[model samples]
Target: MQHEHWWPRPYRFDALLAPGVARARDCAGGIIVVKQGGVPAPLLRLRHPHLAAVVAADCHHHVLAWAGGVPMARLAGRVPVAAAVRWTGQLLAALACLHDAGVVHRDVTAANAMVVGTDAVLIDYGLAAPPGSCAVAGTPASTAPEGWRGHADARSDLFAVGVLLYRLLTGRHPFPGPPFAALQRILHGPVAAPSTQAPQCGSAFDPLLARALAARPSDRFASAAAMAAALDAAQAAFKLHCAANGGLARVAGECRKNGNRNDKYRERERKYRV
Candidate 1:
């Protein structure tokens, strides 16, 4: 007699996407990922354009609809300000939707964010929970100060966004060191302005980052939508300042043109399902 299996039927394992995660192809040849963990209760029905879709779930493992792309971790410290602004906006929108559903991602790190063509998709809901859930879970470097205290909320995710944006802009973590050292710095050390390391960022991002990375959650943007709007305004101001100084304006313009071309290319790729 054939033995029983752990994962559900109608799905065959194709390849290992990572440790504890495997890519599984459905009967119709659609790609999905089976992750070795329980789906957080709060996110069982959560869905958003920028978030990876959950297809099925059980206590032992959960499957997510797959999107082909590169992880943001691989592109860390190399993303241009123009691209960073766009991608960050996408992430914020995802967070806003999650927050509206009364869920907090808890862990929003570079590895969890993917760049699919010209769009950004937030993936991996393994650490997601409702706001005010007391648990310390997430990548050490990206965890907020409040996270260290066993408290997590929407604003805590915003702190991680600040760290991610800082890395994209400056090409380095705001607090760099071993995991423990980084935690100490996050809890007590001061973060430098992004422009100090990346002159291209200019002063426009200084205040915005300060507010996002603030040690106190109350001092940060009230919500993800608010932070997204601030990022848009800051990018516009930075472009204007660059134009006045005759510095990065040309580069920004070139990036925008290239972005448009990329969007068209992505649309074609989607049409062909490439």
Candidate 2:
């Protein structure tokens, strides 16, 4: 008897189930494979128009295999500052695209976000409903505290992006505690700044994060584009500052070289030109 596997393949398999690896399952869906024991290998058997069943050797890509590569949580910890900025910025951009398409990704968290190489891709569509299907799946920390429920709007997606960015910066969830209790607090209380948890960030990022996590959706940035623009500007400002500092150092070096050359030339002229 053949073992049963559960894998769902939709329009396009543009996702990297794992890092540095790509799996292709043709038109028909693919099989969700698993090993019986010992390190747990996978038998991802998918139906191909040409090849009847393409079996992958020593590959694990079951429904659960979505998390095949690195644990996103750990990646968050190991990522350097620049990479985190890029990852969060990309997430915000993806959210903007979804909003432009009139699709609301109610569930947006770090776990649903896959870190492929240096880029971040948003995943998990279980809660992805159309404009108004009335399925609320977003975590509380990613939602407005009051008078905002029912299927979620573009603003909802923005809120989630804010939460994601907060986590990347602080290495902690903005809404922490038991799921139920934490959700309740997020609904009522303002999300504390990442600086609160990561004082190393100082107060520079506090306002930026707070504005994104505002309780009143209206109070928050108008759209994902706007939020992304703000973040981009902040990153640009930092880069510009660094460039200016580097330029200053270069100029100082040139001045020192010229000063030393002038001193030597003057001494030589005094001794020989006279």
Candidate 3:
């Protein structure tokens, strides 16, 4: 996430970028706009000396730019499901790229998954631990079960991704609690499907969200790619149901306008079909 901010004292650009810290150069400002890096050296730095691919630079990239998109939570109201689903792909692709580069993103929430010109870039490595490292930084609710003790791993990142996925769909965190409370719930409470919290979402999507939030890392989708594939399938089903029902609903409304007595039956069918 590039921002209009200045570097702090003791942290210089040359020193920052030397370790291959991820940065964004602002052409307009004629300077590097944002940089995310940490500790000069450790037994192994989880996020520092970070390796990341620049998926997108501008704010217009990714699903957030889709037509009729919902405002980001921090921005305003809920965004359309279509836009959210579209952006889900970008997040998956970004994760794949990082893993391929031999890096594990410790943070993978909606906040870090910023949309840049219709592209989503994984940002904020403050708590990122190197692959297989025993260091972790990220919100407790988004952190994996093993992360409570500062264990960062590929699966842990996936867990955070799952939390993000759940939030995108329901507009609420599955585990809602203060830092300590949320962490305790995540460490002890059973995973709840989004449908369970928001029954309006229907049963079709609950399992996928549940699988993503599974307590056992192995039980969750083996990788972000797998989760994406599963979400793609669920989204297909959701769209199909909507398309079929939407057309019927419109016809029923038309029948009502014409004062057709039988329109009541059609309305029922439309409701169930949709």
Candidate 4:
């Protein structure tokens, strides 16, 4: 199994027949081989822009899949604003599709994302589970609060998307720390405005980011589609804001020039009178 990631894949394998096998390696472990054989029936039937199709998988030791291009983590800061927008749309839509298919990705980190040309695909399903399962599965930085209660639903995955969003826009995790400390911050710390952490960020995202990072699931956007819509609107507003600021600066510059001219005229009159 050739893998760009020398770590455990997100989707659990060899588990239906033996439930805990993946938990040990998939939960807190690293570098899982992406190999060939028995993909689950539900996964095979699923179709989403951000998802890597499961080609085959047996009960326990195997799954051959076609995941997309380079890991998103590698291309984080390198992605252009325009390309990031496209990726965001695909990612949210794909997540919505996955939820619609009755699956919860649980793990939605950048390393699990692959950018193949114009498309970005989410990979590593080994830690994934059906919605409502309490057992822990996901990286510390991206896990939702509900995960601590041993329950993660569609919204749980949404939380991870929020984290991914923060990373994509700022190239920094909303919560940064070692594994345990990171999870702690997620559970207790207040979420900050993205602009506060990254001054270059547009303020239009403040409200949307707040909702996405809400501590309670109900407080967050109802679904991935809804979040995507909000983001679209915010991005639009951001552009408008930038345009307005540019206009204001230009006007200010003109006013300053006019004032300078007036000052010069007043000085000339005083000298002539003398």
185-233 per-residue lDDT for model 1 (tens digits): 8988788888777665578899889999998899999999999999989
Candidate 4 stretches with Cα past 4 Å from truth are: 1-40, 61-64, 247-274
lDDT of 2 by residue, 51-82 (tens): 11213222233232332333345544333335
Per-residue alpha-carbon lDDT of candidate 4 for residues 164-274, written as tens digits (9 for 90 to 100): 777765667788878787777788767778776544445777888888877789988889989889989977876676576674244224323433223343332233221
Candidate 4 CA-lDDT value: 0.65
Task: Judge candidate 3 against the unseen true structure and give its global Cα lDDT, from 0 to 1.
Answer: 0.54
- lDDT for each residue of candidate 3 in 121-185, tens digit (9 for 90 to 100): 55544454457666656665678877767766677777777777677656678788688778776
Name the candidate that leads on lDDT: 1
Off by over 4 Å in 1: 1-8, 247-274
Best prediction by TM-score: 1
Model 1 scores worst on lDDT over the 10 consecutive residues at 265-274
- Candidate 4 positional error at 220, Å: 1.0
lDDT of 2: 0.54
Candidate 4 versus the native: TM-score? 0.73
Q: How far is candidate 4 from the true structure (C-alpha RMSD, Å)?
A: 14.6
Clash count list over all predictions: 0, 1, 13, 24
Pairing residues by index, what is the TM-score of model 3? 0.65
Predicted structure 2: clash tally: 1
Angstrom error of the Cα, residue 99, model 4: value is 0.7
Ranking by TM-score: 1, 4, 3, 2
